[model samples]
Target: MGTLDSDDLKSGVDLKSQTDDVSLVDERTAEQKKIDDWLPITSSRNAKWYYAAFHNVTAMVGAGVLSLPYAMSNLGWGPGVVILILSWVITLYTLWQMVEMHEMVPGKRFDRYHELGQEAFGEKLGLYIVVPQQLICEVGVDIVYMVTGGASLKKIHDIIWDGAPKIKTTYFIMIFASVHFVLSHLPNFNSISGVSLAAAVMSLTYSTIAWSASIHKGMQQNVEYGYKGKDRAETTFNFFTALGDVAFAYAGHNVVLEIQATIPSTPEKPSKGPMWRGVLVAYIVVALCYFPVALIGYYMFGNEVDDNILISLNKPKWLIAAANFFVVIHVIGSYQIYAMPVFDMIETLLVKKLKFKPTFALRFISRNIYVAFTMFVAITFPFFGGLLGFFGGFAFAPTTYFLPCIMWLAIYKPKRFSLSWCTNWICIFLGLCLMILSPIGGLQNIIKKAKDYKFYN
Candidate 1:
C-alpha cells in the first residue's frame, strides 16, 4: 500500500476510539444527544419573548394582587413601597441566579424546579421536598382562583339579574369548574400562553378599572386619600400578614423554569437571554399595573380596605360588574396555568413509576379528575383568608426566597464568605425569618376572622 499521511492515521485512530466508547454510554445518555428524543418539538417551543412574557405576567398577576393595597394599608405607603421594591429585587435576583444554574447543564434544560433541586442536592430531596412544595403552592393557588372566580361570577350575576334567587357561591364554582376542566385539556404550557395573554389583558383591564375607580373615589369631596393605617399594635401584627400577602403576590417562581423551557433554544442563542428578556419585560409590566392599583386602592379605602380591594370599590354597579367579570376570566385562565405543572408531575409519575403510557385518553381522564378534586377542596374550605395566609406563609417564603438562595449556594459552592456566598446567606437568613414569622402572623389573623368563615357561602 501507498504511504498514508499522519493526519489519516490520527483520524482513523480517533474514529476507532469513539466507536469503542459508544457502547459504554447508557441508553438515556445516548437518547439525550438528540434533544427531540426527550422533549417534543412542538408549537409550544416556538414562542417569542413577548409571548413568553405575557405568560409570566399572567402567572404573577392574580387574586393575590388584589391584596396588595390591603398589604400596603397595613404598612404605610413609604414602608409598603420599600417592601414591594425589596421583594421585587430579591425575587428578580434569585430568578436570575436560577437561570444561571439552568445554564450549567450545557445542552440540557430543566423543565421544573424539582429538576433543579435534584441536580443541586439529591434526587430524594428534590422529589420529596421541592415537588411537594410546588404541588401545595400551585394546587392551593388553583383553589383560591376557584373561590375568587366564583365570587366574581356571582357578583356579575347579581348585578345583571337584580334580585335573582341568590344562588350559593358553590353553584358558581361548579360552573367554573366545568369550564376550567375543559380549558385544562389544552396540551401544554406553551399552548396555554394564548389563554394567559388574554388573562393578562383581563388582569390589566380590571386593575385599570379598579385604579380609576379608586382615584375617582379618593378625589371626591370628604374622602381622605393618604397613609391610612392606624391602631399601631393592630398594624404591627397585620404588617406580617402583609408580608405574606406580598409574598403570595410574587409567587410565580415555582413555574418559572416550566415557562422557560417553552422557549425555543438554539446553539448560538440559548434560552438564557430570552428567559431574562421575557422576565424583565414581564416584571416591568407587573410593577406598573401592581403599584398603581395597590397605591391608589389603599389611598381610597384606607384602613377600611377589604383583602380584595375590588370589593371595597364604590364604583357604579355596571363598572364593578365589568371588573368582576374580568377577574373571573383572569382567574379562570390562571388556574389552568398553575395547575398544569401538577398535572404534568402526576402524569410523568404514572408513566415512569406505573409504566402507564401517555395516551390521549389517559391524559384527558387524569386531568379532568384532578380538576374535579381541586373543585372539591375549594368547596370544602370556603376559607379564603385562612388559605391565603397558610399557603402564603408556608410556601411563598421558602420557595420564592429561601430555597432559591440555598440552591445557588449548593450549586456554585462559591468561596467562603465571598460576595456570592454572603449575599446568598443573607437571603437565606431573611427568608428563614419570614418563614418563621409570617405563618404565626397569618394564622392569628385567620383565627381572628374564623367566626365569619363559611363553606361556599
Candidate 2:
C-alpha cells in the first residue's frame, strides 16, 4: 500500500508539471500572435497576386528608370544593351527563386526576408547578413526617392513658371516627405494597393512620355555615341558606376519575399503559383519601361544626356511638366512601398526587442522619426545620381542580383556539376563583381560632385 501511494504521487506531480508548461507556452504564443497581428507586414494576408504585380511595378520602376539613359551614356551602345537585358533575365530568375522559397518548407510561411534568411543561414547569422543589406536598400531607396520627388517638383515649378520666384529644393523635398507622414500610418500592404496601382500607371505613363518625347525632340546635333570619360581610367570608373545605376534600376528583389507574404497561401494551391504569375506580369512591364527609355534616350542625347532623362527633354512645356508631375506621383507611391518594410522593422524592434507596447503612440513617434531622418539626409546630400549608384551597388546588387541565388544554393543544394548549380554560380560571380567594383566608382563620382556642390542648395 505504501509503494502504490508513492508511485501515484510521483505520476501526479509529473502530469502537473507538464500541464503547467503547456499553459505557459500557450500564453506566450497567444501574445506573439497579437504582436504579429499588429505589425504592418503580418497584419494582413488577403492580398491578391496582382497586388504583387503593381506593388512590384511601383517598387522597381521609380527614379532609377530616369537614370537609365545616362547609364547607357557611360556604358555605350553594345555593353549597355547587353547589361540591361542580362539584368532583367537574372533578376527575374532570382525573383522566381524567392517566390518558390517563400513556402518551400510546407505548412509554414516565411513571411519576411530575414525569416527566410534564418532558414538558410542560422538565426543570428541570417539576421546579421540580410537585415543590414535590406535596411540599406530600403532606406537608401526612400532617400533617393525623396531627392527624385523634390527634383521633379522643382521641374514642374520651373516649367509652369519659367521665371517665377524659385523655391529651394530643400523645401520641395520637405513637401514630398510630408505626404508620407500620413500615408505611412496605413496598417499593411493590402491597404495601400490602390495607391500602388495608381503609381504603377504613372510609371508607365512617364516612361512612355520620356521615350516619346525623346523621339519628338529628335537626335541632337553632334550627338556622340562615344564614351563620356576623357581617359581610360575615368572610362573604367564611369562604367562601374553605370553598372550600379543599372543594378539600382532592377531593385525589386529586396521586397519580393515580403510582397509574396501578402498573398493567401494554401496546401492545395500554394502562394508561389500566383506570386510567380504576378512576377511575370511585373517583369513584362519592367522590360517595357526600361528598354525604350534606355535605348531611345541614349540614342537621342548620347554622351551629353542628363543623369535624369526628363531634365534633358525641355521642349513642349506642358508635356514636360506633365511628365514631371507623373514622376512625382510615381515616386510618391514608390517611397511608401519601400518605407513599408522599414516601418515593419522599426515596429518589430520596438515591440519585440525593446518590450514597448504596440500602441498608436509608439507607431506614430517611430514612423515620424524615420521620415524626418530620411528627409534630412535627402536635403543635405541631394546628389540624386551619386546616391543611386552608391546605394545600388552597395546594397541593391546583393539583394537583387545574388543574395537570392546564395540562399537558393544554400537551401536547395543542387548537385555540384548540375545546370542549376552552374547558373547560380554564374549569377553569384556577376553579382559579387557588381558588389565589389560598382561602389568604388560610385564613391569617386560622389566625391567629384561634392567638390563643386553646395549643401541644401
Candidate 3:
C-alpha cells in the first residue's frame, strides 16, 4: 500500500512539472507575440501585391534618378549606357531572387533583411554582416532624402521668388525633416502605403518633367560630351563616383523582403506571386523614369548639367516650380519608406533586447531622435552629389547589387558552374569592385566640395 501511494505522488509531481514548463513557454511566446504585433514590419500582413509596386517605386525612384545624367557625363556614351542597362537587368534578377527566397523555408518567413541574413549566415554572424550594412544603406538614404527634399524646396523658393532674400538650406532641411517627425510615428509599412503610392506617382511625374524640359531647352551651346573632369586623374575618380550614383538609383532591393512581409501568404499561394507582380509594374515605372532622364538629360545638357536635372531647367517658371514641389512630395514618402525599417530595428532592439516596454512614449522619443540626427547630418553636409556616391558605393552596392546573390549562393548552393552560380558570382564580383572603388571617388568629391563649403550654410 505504501508503494502504491509513493508511485501516485511521484506521478502527480511529474505532471505538475510538465504543466509548469508548458505554462512558462506559453507566457514567453505570448509576450513575443505582443512584441511582434506591435512592431511596424510584422504588425500587418494584409498588403496586396500592388502595395509592393508603389512602395517599391517610392523606395527605388528617389533623388538618385536626378543624378543619372550627371553619372552619364562621367561615364560617357558607351560605358554609361552599358552600365545602366546591365544594372537594370542585374538588379531585377536579384530582386526576383529575394522574392522567391521570402518563403523558401516552409512555414517560415524571413520578415526582415537581417532575418534572412540570420538564416544564411547563422545568428551572430548574420546580424553582424547584414545589420550594419542595412542600417547604413537605409539611414544613408534618409540623409540623402533630407538634402534632396530641402534642396527641392529651396529650388522652388528660389525660382518663384527669383533672387529674394536667400533662405539658408539648413532651414529648408529642417522644414523637410519636420514632415518625417509626424509620419515616422505611423507604426508600420502597410499604414504608409498611401503615402508611398503618392510618392511613386510623384516620382514618375517629376521624371517626365525633367526629361521633357531638357528636350524643350534643346542642347546647350558649347555642350561637351567629353568627361567633365579637368584631367585624367580627376576623370578616373569621376568615373568611379558615377558608378556609385547608378548603384544608388537601384537601391529598392534593400527593402524588398520587408515589403514582402507586408503581403498575405499561405501554403498554397505564397507572397511571392503577388509581390512579383507588383515588382514587375514598379520596374516598368523605374525604366520609364530612369532611361529617359539619364539619356535625354545628358544628351541635352552634356557635361554642364547640375547633379539634379530639375535644377538645370529654370525656363518655363511654373513647370519647374511644380516639378520641385513634386520632388518634395515624392521624397517625403521615400523618407518614410526608408525610415519605417529603421523604426522597426530600433523598436525591436528596445522592446526585445533592452526589455523596454513597447509604449508610445518610447516610439515617439526614439523616432524623433532619429529624424533629428539625419536632419542634422543633412544640414551640416548638404553635399548632394558627393553624399550619393559615398552612400551608394559604401552601403548600397552590397545590399542592392550583390548581397542577395551572396545569400542565394550560401542558401541554395546551386550546381557548380551552372548558370545560376555563374550569374551570382559575376554579380558578387562586380558588386565588390563597386564597393571598393566608388567610395574612394565619393570621399574625394566630398573633400573637394568641403574646400569651398561653409558648414551649415
The positional error of residue 236 in candidate 2, measured at the CA in angstroms, is 1.3
TM-score of candidate 2 against the unseen true structure: 0.93
Worst 10 residues of 1 by lDDT: 34-43
Global lDDT of each model?
0.79, 0.90, 0.91
**Model 3, stretches more than 4 Å misplaced?**
1-29
- Report the error of model 2 at residue 209, Å: 0.3
lDDT of 1: 0.79
Model 3 clash pairs are none
TM-score of each: 0.89, 0.93, 0.93
Per-residue accuracy of model 1 over 1-457 as CA lDDT, tens digit each: 8887999999999998877766654554664343223222222576778866887888888867877888887777788888888888888888888766766786577767899999888989777779878887898899888888887888899888998889998988898898987898887877777789999899888888888888876743454534443566666677777877888888888888888777788669988788889899888878877889888887777767888887787368889898889988899888977887887777766765787765778878888888898889878776755666766677788888879889888888999989989988988887887777677767877787776776556
Tell me how candidate 3 scores on lDDT. 0.91
Query: CA shift at 153, candidate 1, in angstroms?
Result: 0.3
lDDT of candidate 3 over 51-80, digit per residue (tens): 999999999998789889989999999999
Report the error of model 3 at residue 245, Å.
0.6
Model 1 residue 396 CA deviation (Å) reads 1.0
